[model samples]
Target: MGERRDTQLDALRAVAVSLVLYAHFLAPGGTSFLGHLGVRLFFVLSGFLITRLLLEARDAAAFEAGPALRSFYVRRAIRIFPPYFAVLGLVWFTDLEQSRSSLTWHALYLSNFWYALRNDWTPWVLCHLWSLSIEEQFYVAWPVIMLLAPRKRIEAITIGAIAFSLAYRFYWPITAVPALARDLLPPASMDALACGGLLAVRRARGADVPRWMRRGWPAFAAAFLAVVWS
Candidate 1:
């Protein structure tokens, strides 16, 4: 039910990947902020694409939630787990100290929690996995949210998620919590995903791009830069 691919999205993915490469390889000191921007872009793209697939699956299954949910989970595991485990297997075979030290957390997709609680990126080779952990968290949680919410209320639910994420990010800096926790935790980082989901919902309903969004991207860009650079 989700076989179609968008060339536009492919182009966007290429751009996102290039940005991450630039950040990691070219940016002086490997500016982590730029890498973060790339990861956030990937998150938004994933939310849009995955939500669209789930919507299509639901419709194709005649809203039979069980079959759609099971199919999605199966496809996701087959697609995601093999390559992931292959990497871990290589790490284990080579006896990489950092990976060996934290293999359990990485295998369980809980590396984000490990890094945040430790408040240090000791295993730099595995540092990138925190984002993957966030993505896995999104995959596990988003389908249930999409299927259980009333169709008409889905948009509202997504917006509420975005609001909660933004609020958490704003409030977190004042707390005694580690900065890594605020940035790595799912709750504080959901705004980009929710915004992507909102866009998918609107497009599925055949709604035109809102006038505000069409005109406000510059403003949005400015605001995002301010927050990231602050």
Candidate 2:
């Protein structure tokens, strides 16, 4: 089951990356809807995979908060920081004029917030790091919640997060909130991640796939069409 799921996820990742590359190279002005969809797909996929890993760790014997958190942080740092700093260093050395003042924000994983407030000042190459910052921020909060919350309440929490994210995005105009608050922040984007986490929880609990979704190619066709239309 795990192998099959991993294969499916790899396929999805390939599709998402392909869409992003296509948008960058083929689409006019690099503003294609496909590019946005690709990023959303990545966000959902990341949430699902990370939650599944944490769930597995929780199920293992001798799980403890301190050790689990330390391991998680160490693993994340090793996996993420090396390549990230390398790229940042290259950008800093080659494009000092554009990256000098804003390098601190990237280093501190607050590039998203910085860009939100000063959209016009963002260097194009580092603009993409905004999503990475959001993911890092989510990682900080999710493990603690998962460790402390009752298993029965996990789904409820995920659903509540999704609802809160939707409300934050939708209510911004009505409340006259600044665009910066709603656009690049983690809260406004939690819905997609929470949706993925919810699915992971349901699957882990052995919930059956819905009849409509289990109908095979027809269901797949409908989903594909919906995505294309969107």
Candidate 3:
């Protein structure tokens, strides 16, 4: 366990979780600027590390997606699905706030798709869980894509995904801004994850991105700060 530990990552996780708690609980209007920053940090870090791991798995001359596919789905299922349902059920059934006609749909991570289909921002019952929904959606699709996607294709997808996300934000400034403003969801939120994945691949090829990011921490902090503060 100790061997697996990355001190900087551990520190960041601690900070991120703490900020999430503080942002949700203490931040005014059920949100906080600092708290929001915490989550962004997490997304970036998750991208960075998860991609790195994927690249490592790709190497070892072991690009076979079998192990990655099985391990990831299983771990994600155990860690996310059960607890998510448990919590969603608890909140809805107990009427923690209010009852609703439908919830299982959201529990299934179809909220965004539904939101795209219909539009129910109310019943903010498990609003926070939406991020997890996006993540689950990512797990369901990304790994399969990652497993099959050629190295160049994966990189292009990552770049394109990020670009489209940003374009949505820029074009639909009103819509994208709010999502980005929200702690959980940003307009091109998944791009950061993809970016991390890209970074991971670069690392696999012995092309260093981590060192650049670390040394350019000032730039990263500035760019992130602009987005958060804006």
Candidate 4:
């Protein structure tokens, strides 16, 4: 059976995209934070949807990891790669010099690393690919962790991931790591993904959010403040 549509999540996606569009196109200066929030929302949404699908698949398959893993990779590749390569092809045919020069990294799904290593966002045309690269990296590893881990351990694993991401984000800044790399590295950004995954796992287990979090606005406000603090 096909998954049910989620209108709330659809609204969130629309809002996130609008935030990014407005940040990049409509807003003047000092609005990069909006763009960051939009991208973080996208990361969370992707994590939630993908983990939910995997959990559903696992249950349907009676926890058969092989089939679930195969189905995920195949579907992910089909849905992600074609349009990605098509975009690259357009860039190539149009002779976009900067994007074309970096096309190899994007094609290999290493654009994030390439940008982080350089500590720059040159080839501005392809700068956005860094987030896509992080998503692809997460896609590669998350299914294995989600599908293969013991059912009871899923929450713990997700929590550990969130902790690890937070630790990395916190620890990197105090060290010599370049700012771009600190922010763009996969580990540093996994908290949002893991937070989303945690929500999916809890939902799949038929668990409701804690009572303290049940009121939506308060939780949202707290999260917004936490993001600002971090």
Ranking by lDDT: 1, 4, 2, 3
Report clash pairs, candidate 4. none
lDDT of 2 by residue, 63-139 (tens): 88777777777888888999999999998899855787788999989888887777443586788788889999998
Give candidate 4's TM-score.
Answer: 0.90
Q: How big is the positional error of residue 98 in model 2, measured in Å on the Cα after superposition? A: 1.6
Clashing pairs in 2: none
Candidate 2, superposed: residue stretches over 4 Å from native:
1-5, 175-181, 210-230
Best by TM-score: 1
Using TM-score as the measure, name the better of candidate 2 and candidate 4: 4
TM-score against truth, every candidate: 0.94, 0.85, 0.77, 0.90
Error of 1 at 157 (Å): 0.8
Which residue runs does candidate 3 get wrong by more than 4 Å? 1-4, 60-63, 111-121, 174-187, 210-220
TM-score: the better of candidates 1 and 2:
1
- lDDT per residue for candidate 4 within 56-114, as digits (tens), equals 88788465888778878888888799999998899888867557778889899998888
Please give, for residues 131-229, the per-residue lDDT of candidate 1 as tens digits.
899989999999998877788998999899988988888888899367789888898669889888998998889999889988998998998776655
- Candidate 4 residues lying further than 4 Å off, grouped into runs, are 61-63, 212-230
What lDDT does each candidate get?
A: 0.84, 0.78, 0.65, 0.84
| Cα error of candidate 2 at position 2, Å | 12
lDDT of 1 at 76: 85
* Better candidate number, 1 or 4, judged by TM-score: 1
lDDT of 3 by residue, 1-230 (tens): 00145897899899989988898777788356776677666766777775665555665465568877787677667767787788777877687656345476676785555443344455566656656666667667767776677877877777777777656545554654344333233344675667666776666677755677779999967875766665
